[model samples]
Target: MAATAVLQPYNEAQYDHRAFDSLMDVDESAYYFDSLTGYEHLRSGLRDIFMRHGVSDELAVALLHRHFEMSTNEKLVELGPVSSPWPIAAHEDSVLGGHILPHTWRVFENELHPLEFRFIPQQEFQDARKVQFSQAFFEDFRQYVKANGLENVVGITQLDHGRDADESDVQLMEVTHGRNSIMVPAVPSSDVSGPAFQTIWSFVEKQSSKLDADGIQTRHGLCYKASSTDAANDGIQTRHGLCYKATSTDASNDGIQTRHGLCYKASSTDAANDGIQTRHGLCYKADSTDATTDGIQTRHGLCYKANSNDGIQTNHGLCYKATSTNTTNDGIQTRHGLCYKANSNPTTA
Candidate 1:
């Protein structure tokens, strides 16, 4: 039977989406206040409104003039604690790391005070309307998918509205989620043409369901002549599979028989027959007192086997050098290089 597939379609024009301008129209107009109570009420209302539209609490307070200003021109001649040494205004650095000299020095009670430095524009929001809307829409869609248990989704089809329904763009995507997903294509079929257009819904659907292709179970067994030493033989390395080894003369005379020649059996049996022994990681110099000291003498001089508890080990059974002696901790060292031994359970961390 053909495998079943799920299709999810979203039409942007059908939804009653709000305009970007409508969401960002913050009221910065001044309000009239006859009493202290009226002023407080107005301030509170403005703060709530600003916050509802994504404004931060600090920015809302600043906008309402509830926060104190440290760079005000009126503070130039104000009296401050004279105990601190007065540094020249030109020596002072602005927030931008630039040296800014004041316009003039105020003579307050015959004491000179720096006054009126250049004001630099602070950073503001840089996201464009289209980008912000795309991000918001994606986040909302992710939440919707999670809440509705659509985590097993295979693909997505989106229709973006243009000036008219006929000019709309259709986006098609085949997604495989592992660590994180990425955008493939957003350009509509109506806007562009060529090989790049094949990534659309129709093409992906056709490719995913193409027939006459062999499945894993129905695949044929691979055939090739054995190497002289039979060192790097390539065969079907799947579970429950077996390989037949034979000399070239015997193979030719036997007319390429199946399950005929000497059997190497499975991986473990074959590895043993090949005389491959546990390298135990390469021989490293280890002290006699070290726990990992193998005490075996070989052609590579005095070498020690890596500890089994070390986090990273080569197929031969040696621990990685960097894994043992990083900047943070000192691992066990002997004739065998540095060996890392976890004081605590590594799995818990």
Candidate 2:
């Protein structure tokens, strides 16, 4: 007699099909696992089967999701065919840095298996998106993977989009090797209103200290000026009429006179002199003395001497050494102070 063949009914419960229902039905899925032994057995078997077929573990897991309607509920089991093959057509490649796409079944060229289909879960898709280029964080991630012996595995960085999405809805950043693409969240970093820039600035500031003692060479850093007065004044004041007093006893001068990366001096007595000075390499008066002597004296560079008390005094004067009546011999010399023409000698003046 010929051996009788028996066919068994597909037992959805055997491999935990209920888990798939939960995963498909819910917006998010939690991990499920059978007993420890079952988990090990399924994983080993699936890996062996895939290895024999020359499929990668990643691709194999994807195939399970695609063709078998199978998902890990802590262990692998047959869930039967829940859906038809959803092959991803080629030419849909749109990989960019800092972006994410929905996960789905796709066909890719495998080294051993020419054409292979894999189901990339939303999580795996998210993991792939987190890769950043040429960043310290990326280097750190590389070190971590190397240390953990997970060089082939991807790392994730969760981005918090408060109020816009649920607390659980975190965008991820992935770090992986051999990929020249970056996967970021769907939302642009510009759209997300958070302390990301501030955090970056803070990091830059920290790193800047090591590179230069002056710190970041930007004018955006904080600047604190000792008030002309010791009184607590924490309100905005007008830029003008708050000049630096030439005399040390000028008690009216009371507040910060200059902003960051600037300096102040009580030099300009011109009508434009507001008592405050800027290190903009502009000319200003050093004293109320006659135009012949008090000519424009810059806080940093050469001073121009006035020839007369008349308005022409502002025009007829040779540039002199700062704080001195001595004539500057250089022609067209540019310094961090006032701009003026130098006289060859006092006789020429």
Candidate 3:
């Protein structure tokens, strides 16, 4: 609520009642009283009067003037302050980082979701016209979605409650999620029974559903990966069932697999052995060309080779550097002046 203001006494010497009389004739729908210099205090009381319960675009301007008179008339019954609240102003920032009545909000599945949204010009709020509200990602937010290759996001708003239809002024549910939900949230009012109060608060409360967070998401899991991580991570993250799509593929692999894989597992162990390799683990070959694909080489104490002329020869040079003058003979090597030859043929080794 706006803080109560410091009132000023009518100064009969400097100023006369003539100046205040002009304020009586102006209409209330869009009222702005002129300020005497250095008198910021006088503006607060008048400003408060304009900001009470939301004025609908459809409300008769004369009725609005009457309402204003009822609230501000000096001769009205002095029964003390009415059980009213501070008015919601267009530019005022709320504790929730948005407005009580968001600039533009959406409703889906009969639930209210207040958001800091905006609109494109049409006529006025009273005209049966349309506007845009942006969330998630879009080409450009301030521009009309139609202007930016998108259609308007369909939804509803309650101009009366200053909230979504589903949220009562005070929350009754005990929100729960470990430390994540124990924090206080800024609500419109604390009284649950308030005639026109609502909130988007966070509180500790028990949920009675048997399913986990997965169920509230209206999306089928096939489209996007739900974060087992953040509560709002690409999942049902808002009051209107704003679900971020799961990846088109189950990149998280949640509860989905090959149809054939599930069929075999359903059979009993006593059934005949399936004619397929059931072994499952990292498969490594004993001999994978005897070299790592990354170009790193490993070998035993002695090198080994497979030659067309010689099958699996040990202590052989698969590839080696020979820095010597060498000669070949019938399967024999002679001293420093080395000589080698095939056992059967002198031409090959």
Candidate 4:
């Protein structure tokens, strides 16, 4: 009798959204087989079918794994040529195998339609990675979301690279509640790849917010990025998510416009409008001159009580005055005391 391999029956949850580069040491136990002979026969059949059909060996193992997990029969019974659930592209070295299945697929009234597949060349994939992204990335992603017309991305799950990479740097990401995943790059980067997944999720969020019932950008300014620095120069800036930018200016004033919005001049008589100056060049705006509110609490605490008329008005509507004495604020105290903190409201030019 031939030695029978004790198969560790395929567990559906254990193999979700997995990616495998090579098939050299795939655990035979993870797959279901009646006998050692059955396993060998199945591998032979799969190898023959895949080789004849121009399927990569890596993808062959992946397809079988998927079939095993999804089928109710749960037996290694099929020896026929199997169509891949997803579009297949041949990798020169290893198959892009392992649970590369779609989370959901649509059927019409319980009738299965012929699925279409496309095989993109690996060189084209490499070429795509070189494209410079800024606004164009958002535009293309916006179109993708619009075409899919799917719901917002509710969650992001990282996938295992399956012995190909260390645990700290798995880059594959699955976007939940969306039509398909936002695949992370295969390259390992503990610092960049981890945050890249979050970036993708955030991009989805902004696009979804801008998308209306018709999946159009009819609701403007939701995910808006200033094409020119005109909006930033004018003190109208949106800081949330992808739209965040550092406040830079040529304006010589006590206050600076920032991503928070516009910083304006406050009335000195109203104690509520005056407080310690913050590093962003805004007054903390206290209701009363208490110990916490009156003292130099912040690093940019160049705040002082002075006449509103003594203040010089900024282009951004903020008030500033030249200080007589030096102070310990982050900026040079040659200019001192901002009257109001920046607000989310945009001022008209």
**Each prediction's TM-score versus the true structure:** 0.14, 0.16, 0.13, 0.20
Off by over 4 Å in 2: 1-130, 133-251, 254-263, 267-349
- lDDT digits (tens) for residues 1-349 of candidate 2: 1232342322111222232222210000001112122223223433333233322212212211111232232222111111122222232322232222222211111101111112234444554422112233233333433443322211121122111335323332211111111222223221211111000000012121112221111111111111112212333221111233334332336532332222343343233555433332333433443333444433111122322221110111111111112344322111112233333221111
C-alpha RMSD in Å of predicted model 1 compared with the true structure: 30.3
Per-residue accuracy of model 4 over 103-204 as CA lDDT, tens digit each: 211121222111112222444444321111123222332343234331122111111212233542322321111112122222211111001111111011
Error of 1 at 66 (Å): 39
Residue 250: error of model 1 in Å? 30
lDDT of 1 by residue, 1-349 (tens): 2332332332122111111111110111111122223223222332233223332211111111110112221221111111111232323333442323232221222222233222222331122111111333333333433443321221122112011344323222211111111222222211211111011111111112211111100000011111111313342221111234323323454443222112322343223444322221122233433433442322111122233221111111100111111324322211112222312111100
The per-model lDDT (C-alpha) reads 0.21, 0.23, 0.20, 0.22
> Which sequence of candidate numbers ranks them by TM-score, best first?
4, 2, 1, 3
Poorly placed runs, candidate 1 (over 4 Å):
1-136, 145-324, 327-349
- Listed per candidate, the RMSD to the true structure in angstroms reads 30.3, 29.6, 36.3, 25.3
Q: What lDDT tens digits, residue by residue, belong to model 3 across residues 1-349?
A: 2343443322111111121122221111112211221012112321122223111121101100111111111211101111112333333433232222232232212222322222212332344233222221111211222332211222122221222345423222211121111112222111111011011111111232221211111100011001121333333221111222234223233433112112222232322443221111111222343334222121211122211121111210111111112223212211212233212211111
Task: Tally clashes: model 3.
Answer: 13
After TM-score superposition, what is the CA distance of residue 205 in candidate 4 from its true location, in Å?
A: 26
Best by TM-score: 4
For candidate 4, the TM-score is: 0.20
* Deviation in Å, model 3, residue 112 alpha carbon: 20
